[model samples]
Target: MSALDIFENDSDDTKSAIMRATYHALCEHGYANLTIQRIGDEFAKSKSLLYHHYDSKDELLVDFLEFVLEKFKADIPAEEYDDPCAHLREVLDHVVPPTLDAERYEFTSAMIELRAQAPHDEAYREQFSRNDRFFRQQFADVVRDGVETGAFRDVDPEQAAALLVTTINGSMLERVTTDDAEDAIRATRRELDAYIDSHLLAESGE
Candidate 1:
């Protein structure tokens, strides 16, 4: 029996299988091509089964995206830095190794495609916007804390947050699929460090 057929639409097992099938479908096919027909075929079940669990392909896709996004959020190490730049080190430490590994590089392409096409789907666009804002806010909160603690160089944390996010997003095109990204990430950090340090540090010693 197909994985979907095993769900058999009776208990929680079916719901769980639907989610699993959706994720496998997304990783293999991406959001644009994923369909109820494909999902049903995979399960040797009817398209109606998916609809019973999810309203539409978009709904399933959103669920899949949320699953991956949650995993990404969970992998982030606890914040150890009071300063934003040091917080940046936490991000780099977490992001750098996976950037080089093709097998583990699952989040980049799908995220890029969704972010780029969000404008076309009103609901998807809103959800994407919400996620973007939350990410920025979290980053800004860390930066702001940095300023209050005398760890970060004094600057507009909001602007710094935007710049920091932009830097990471831009790097995705080059780094996510690359074999060598250490130099690029390092250079970007240096420029950012100079911009921030000159303002935050004591001139006499730092």
Candidate 2:
């Protein structure tokens, strides 16, 4: 599902609406040019409602980031996959998709812009750090499962997870900022698969 789809089933209708509006506004105006007015334009409710909740654009965006993070955690069906290799491949695909359509491209670009602010913004940094930890742990857990099942070669799960996460993050940044994004993503996918084959999968399992 698209990340924005999370807002569709949100329990708090008002907050969901506002979050969705903020997402669209960010996509259109981008991080540098976004403002309350732009978000309000996309919101169906009164502009005053936005002011009632958040005094500043950054304040609302911080909450928006939290909302996205929570919904993202819920969206992942990591436990549903019975096979560790399948689970790992699914996670990799989610991070580095086979294709980047317009919507995905726009959303990813906006998110990368938010990430760029992490060094200077404590709140952004904290949220991103939390997200990074969550992803790393998810990967490590899957690797550990694979090792226990003898589906993968004996390896340090934490180190393997760290390497995969770093590679995915770097690929995402390049995909959003560079002109040769398609080529970069294609190359990333090939290398990731090769890594899995050589370093992760057990010979018998493969």
Candidate 3:
């Protein structure tokens, strides 16, 4: 599911609506041009409701980031796969998809724009740091499982996870900043798959 889909399952309908509106607005206008008025234009409720909750655009966005982070954690399929190799592939695909459609590309570009503010915004920095740690731990957990099941070579799970996470971050940055995003993504996928085959997958698993 798309990241925005998580808002649909929220218990609080108002908050859910707001988040969905914020997502669409961010995707449409981007981080630089995003405004409370623009978000309210997407929102079905009164604009005063948005102002009632947030004093400024940054305040609303920080809360939006937190909401996104929680929803993202809930969406992780950590227990969905019995095979370690398949689980690893699933994780990799989620982070770096094979294709970049228009909607997804726009969303990713907006998110990267938000990420660029991390150096200046402590809240954004903290949220992103938590996100990174969570994803890295997911990778580490799968690697540990693989090792225990003898499906992967005995490797330091933390180190392997770190490498994979770093690769994913770099690939995402390249996708947003570079013109040749598709080719770059393809190259990243190729190298990452090769890394998995040579470093993680055992002969039996392969």
**Worst ten-residue run, lDDT, model 3?**
1-10
C-alpha positional error of residue 120 in candidate 2 after TM-score superposition, expressed in Å: 0.9
What lDDT is obtained when candidate 1 is compared to the true structure?
Answer: 0.61
Stretches of candidate 2 above 4 Å error? 8-12
Worst 10 residues of 2 by lDDT: 1-10
Candidate 2 structure quality by residue, lDDT tens digits, 5-82? 676666658988899999889888888999999999999999999989999888888888888888888887644556
Candidate 3 residue lDDT tens string, 1-206: 36656765567578888988998899899999999999999999898999999888888888888888888877765455678888888778877886777777788888889889899999889888988898789889889999998989999999999999898888878888888877888888988889898888898624
Model 3 TM-score (2 dp): 0.92
Supply the TM-score for candidate 2. 0.93
TM-score of each: 0.69, 0.93, 0.92
Question: Model 1, stretches more than 4 Å misplaced?
Answer: 1-20, 37-49, 67-84, 96-98, 175-186, 193-206
